[model samples]
Target: MRENEGGQERPGGEVEEPFGFWRGGGAHERVATGFEETPFGEVWERFLESVDTTNVGALTIGYWGADYDTHFVYPVPLLVEAAASFPNLRSIFLGDIEAGQSEISWINHGDITPLLEAFPALERLKVRGADGLVLEPVKHESLRVLRFESGGLPAGVVRAVAGSDLPKLADLGLWLGDEAYGGDSAVDDLAPILSGERLPSLRHLALDDSQFQDEIAEAVASAPVVARLATLSLAMGTLTDRGAEALLSGQPLTHLRKLDLSYHYLSEPMMARVCAALPGVEVDLDDQQEPDEGEFYVEVAE
Candidate 1:
């Protein structure tokens, strides 16, 4: 979120850089690791040698390593090193590998606090995986877009984010996943952001990939942030009639530009209702799923 909320000049003598899915949307530096074809030590050596670190603004890391255990051992140190070296780096997406390297849910992680401390200029950071994840209550001023896609987002990580005071944060996304993989955050635990007191600057909120999608949806329907948000994503969940019904009956979300409800379990009738309710909004109802063995299922459970 380097750009101003309205796409003006960013504060702090900077310009907005492309990030996340839009990583290469602007002038970005791309670096990838051949974990399968090369040794980790060699990969690090090459990464160290191949970048215009001083002038780099956006960096997208590809395929840190393979499997559940190996990913934990490679990137953190290298990223910490980059944090010190990549002075101009504004955006970083760690663990940008596909399911073949390691599924988003199964990817193992370690402490990421050092990277946060290292890169003072970082305006946006997106990470995959939540297992063994670690984050301290952030006190960053530049970070605006922070997203984590995971199978199971731990409670501590959620609480860490809750207590964080990211004054410039405009987009905050948390994948509060299933409890079986340590997605232990309850609806009550997310009181700060859901209450919209923590992130006063947020304009986009994604509380997704959970067993309690309906509960979260119920909360978000009345959340103060909804009045100001540009996009609201509750994708990759078991969002059904109950949750959709809440949105239909709740305060008018007429101000929103996009409503993402991808990977859901909604009946066609209920989906029809949501579409009818928010006629002008771009409602994403793609990948509608069915229950497994008569029980409703979350899309990304590990």
Candidate 2:
């Protein structure tokens, strides 16, 4: 369930994952264009020919080819070259490949700064996978939602995002997965984000799918950023009663509109306590998990 197969929801609407380019007149508002055996360059050329890319609001790049490790590097430049064609491009989802095409951890990625540099008006960006991923902190004014979906997100990427100057960023989601798969970021790397110094407009925050969910929860309990967030998500990790207790004992969360703690390892009593503590808040306690012996596992770690 953690491995994403369908397209994600954007500010405009749900992303449309059409198998191929539209033949004549189909809604190209929020669409995903992809190919399997054919070269991506050819697909790109055909896509430009088929659809009026200028009117497309949101785009998702799904399953480029068989050899994604090398093929993954091609999308950025192609998109950059075709930047003029997508004048209305506001949101983009890179590496939207399903589990059947490639595992989340195995989807090799490259530097995506060019895409941001090209589309200055882009408001949202969501990327999947972290292997070979590179991002240097750059100031972006229009970006409101930035999410990185990974079974193992790199510390460098986390640092880069924290260091970036995003004045209008409202939603930030980072899936800090198991360290075994290259998720090397510690809580210290998240100090800038937790301090709420760089992200002035951040309202919805998700620091999910980590091996050290408890430690992250402990930090988030007292984080200055928590005070500003309307919705806080610490889901898809191995959160036990220990982490839940920290949240309960931390600053009052009655101000928040929603608290997402799905896919957790909390005891029944702790779950009840969380629900009772925030009667006004919409708390999501779905996908309860039990620890195996004394060890715990994250939802997605390849």
Candidate 3:
């Protein structure tokens, strides 16, 4: 999927603005920055000098340069080294590059484990793009929200997240995209998460944008984690009548406040049944899709 806009909203309801190289008059809670020709270091240094980073609670990293697909190893180190400057930093959005700069599958990323290591008090982390992305298993107590938006999320990253220890984490969103890019994860890979053994405080969970949406839906139907979650999302995938049937036949989802099945391939009767079944729940059935030559497709695959 092609992202056209920048991060407009952040955790804790903060508005984000584009980082200005020339020192602006007022301070902002959240800011986004990117570079075209200048080195990332220079832009970062200038941002530090110009903006009062101590007051900044959220930061968004945008396009690095024209050669971002090739040269993608510098930004992580710079952020880790400058962690001391952002004492109040809690939320960070990496790889905010849009479709004009680079496609979601083409945006290159490096090991992001150091960021979690450096920022022990960080609460929210959202990353876009998944090419060459790596996230080693880490233990952090303060993290509350973690989301990954990708056309193809690697199985290694998913396993690492499942293995990691985050006792206080409450929200998790994973886009298990198409296998053609790098999303080779099977339904078995998510057993730990579906079991709810590692994430004790999780209330909101999203397993979205997958080619194997039907299999995931079947697995999720009886997952133990469903009982504890307040909201569950299976949106932006190739979910059809079979997956809906599995959900309807499985454990009662009446406890959940919301069920998101947007951008799906479900039939009209199935959609009606879902809504009728979950009368008290707010079900999102927007963006209904149709098959192309008997082939159903996920929403965000490249």
Stretches of candidate 2 off by over 4 Å are 1-36, 66-73
Candidate 2 clashing pairs, residues 3+ apart or interchain: none
TM-score of each: 0.86, 0.87, 0.88
lDDT of 3 at 295: 89
Poorest stretch of ten by lDDT in candidate 1: 1-10
Top-scoring candidate (TM-score): 3
What's the distance in Å from true for residue 66, model 1?
5.7
Q: Best-fitting candidate, measured by lDDT?
A: 3
Q: Write the per-residue lDDT of candidate 2 for residues 1-302, one digit (tens) a residue.
A: 35422333444784523222222232334323344466666677778888878678778787665443344335788899989988888778788777876788887678888889999998878888887788889899999889898988999999999999999998899999989998999988898999999999998889999988998899988999999887899999989999999999998899987798999999899999999999999899999997788889988888
**For candidate 1, what is the lDDT?**
0.77
For each candidate, the alpha-carbon lDDT, in order, equals: 0.77, 0.82, 0.83
Consecutive 10-residue window with the lowest summed lDDT within model 2: 17-26
Candidate 3, poorest ten consecutive residues by summed lDDT: 17-26
Model 1: what TM-score? Answer: 0.86
RMSD for all candidates, in order, please: 4.6, 4.8, 4.9
